[model samples]
Target: MDINLSLRHLRAFVAVADCGGYSAASRQVNLAQSALSRTIKEIEDELAVSLFDRTTRRVSLTAAGEQLLLNAREAIASFDGAFLRFQHYREGLSGTVSLAALSSVASILLPPVIFEFQSLRPNVRVSLEDGFAGEVVDSVMQGRVDFGITSLPRKKGRLICEKIAADTLTCICSSRHRFASKRSIEWRDIEGEDFVSFALSSSIFEVVEQGLRSADVSLGNITKARDIGTVAGLVSSDLGISVVPSLVLPMMQFCEYRGMPLSNPVVERNIYLIYDPETPMPPASTFLMDLLRRGPRSKFKIPNGVRWIDYPDGSCQANSN
Candidate 1:
């Protein structure tokens, strides 16, 4: 394993033999003619055989040279392949990175981040597919995509989840709602309200239920919404107050009342970037992750009368940059 035989000698031999002369091989391998000649001579000396028969007018491969040429080419290819692999890691912006995500993210934050990344590195191809929480987690574990961006702390998976953002669930309502003017709210107020929410099968529904039950209250006559946007739209139209992630509130075109910290064990979900530790992430994916990091630009703001409490690593604390 410690043998000193090198790729340099192999390349010199192959180039000289293939190019039919040391001078042509020099240009092929980007070496001076004298250097090329010396390299071949050293290789010949090490092999203890003259590889090429050189004449005043021409040079051609000998029996040993012709035979060794194949192995030399194979060695050169392997070395070139190694160099390519190193290049893959050295610069990540030139490759393709695909991700599986919860559609909710596609509605709010994922677009700007994906767009900025693409604009920053036009060569990198970014693709996203939508799936529910369980499906997204499974995709990441199965190596279906580079990673999954979804609500965090996935209960079941052999996955590493890192919180990329924190999202607070808010009870949104029309401006005419009885409690709409209140600066602060509690889950006790939710006791008598009819709820228009996602189905029990939906992840947000689970979060809402857990928050309500923690407050010793039960929601009445729940209606199922298939998507968050629809849920928000209905809530704005006074269908019933619905709860959703905080990041969603700012982007809504509807003039809806949004607020939070439902005093009874306020339940907030951490948005995590999920990946399988067992799989090797491509460098382009890592570059995207580096772009995902929060910076000094992150701070809590009351966007459209909605102020959220974000954990240190949560999305509200994320720098949109």
Candidate 2:
């Protein structure tokens, strides 16, 4: 018997078997009734065996037909499953996306994006690493990850950087502290006070120190912490007050800590999405990047004492309220 059977032949045979007759199978296969019958005849001829017992009153499967029916269904299903997987791959819905992100962005901002992304592409695997801003940048530069979420890269080099959010630096203090009741304070207000801030290696601390320098306000007594979580704990314990990004408020250990807007030299750190333009991203990574770009700033609930400082381009404003 000739094994030269096509998918159309297998499909027509399955259609007739399931539909119980050629007339009904024609409609199911979207082929003419006569064409459908001819397809089944060709498949039977290829196998050199009868596949169905047909009569004027009814059509049913014979012993040979029953065996072929099972094999045919299994073959069609396997082909379709492979085709669907390939289609998903071509559409960029079934690959892995690797990302490196700063600790703050990873904890505060990425969970919603990751949740929504997983719901959309359940087959695509997502991997993320949380590190300092410098580490995140290095991962992108070294091709260790697909892209990174961190403070804007200090030097563009070969990377493309786009701002995702502008997080303002605010003073955090124990509720009982003198500055907590104030609506806003300036760099000068915290001068001469004990300061708990980012470690000297932190990019944010560099920004804060530069801002303080421009304002000519100095804190002689200072302690440094590596992450926002530790900085918040220090403020909560009254060990020392600290300045941190507004996103840290949601993760603070103590509800009694107050966030006060710092002015005179308002410091806003722009969070950026950085990728190597020379390296093409996987389809899954591109899809997730689009989702992150389209996320509305209003979705991030701005806590009290934090105001939306509008930029001239309106890109930094979170919401009107």
Top TM-score model: 2
Off by over 4 Å in 1: 1-90, 153-155, 254-261, 295-321
Residue-level lDDT of model 2, residues 28-112, one tens digit each, is 8899998888888887787889989999966899899999889889999999999998889778789789999988778778887
TM-score of each: 0.67, 0.74
| lDDT measured at residue 211 in model 2 versus the true structure, 0 to 100 | 75
Per-model lDDT: 0.71, 0.80
Clashes of each: 4, 0
Q: Relative to the unseen true structure, what is the C-alpha lDDT of residue 5 in candidate 2, on a scale of 0 to 100?
A: 90
Tens-place lDDT digits, model 1, residues 1-321? 333568888887788877888778899999999998888878777788889899987799889988889888888888898888668656885667989877766556577677767877787788888867777877787788998877653353567666666567776777877767776578888887878888755667777777877888777777788766677777777778777766666656555655554555666765677777678888889877666654224332323322222324443222221
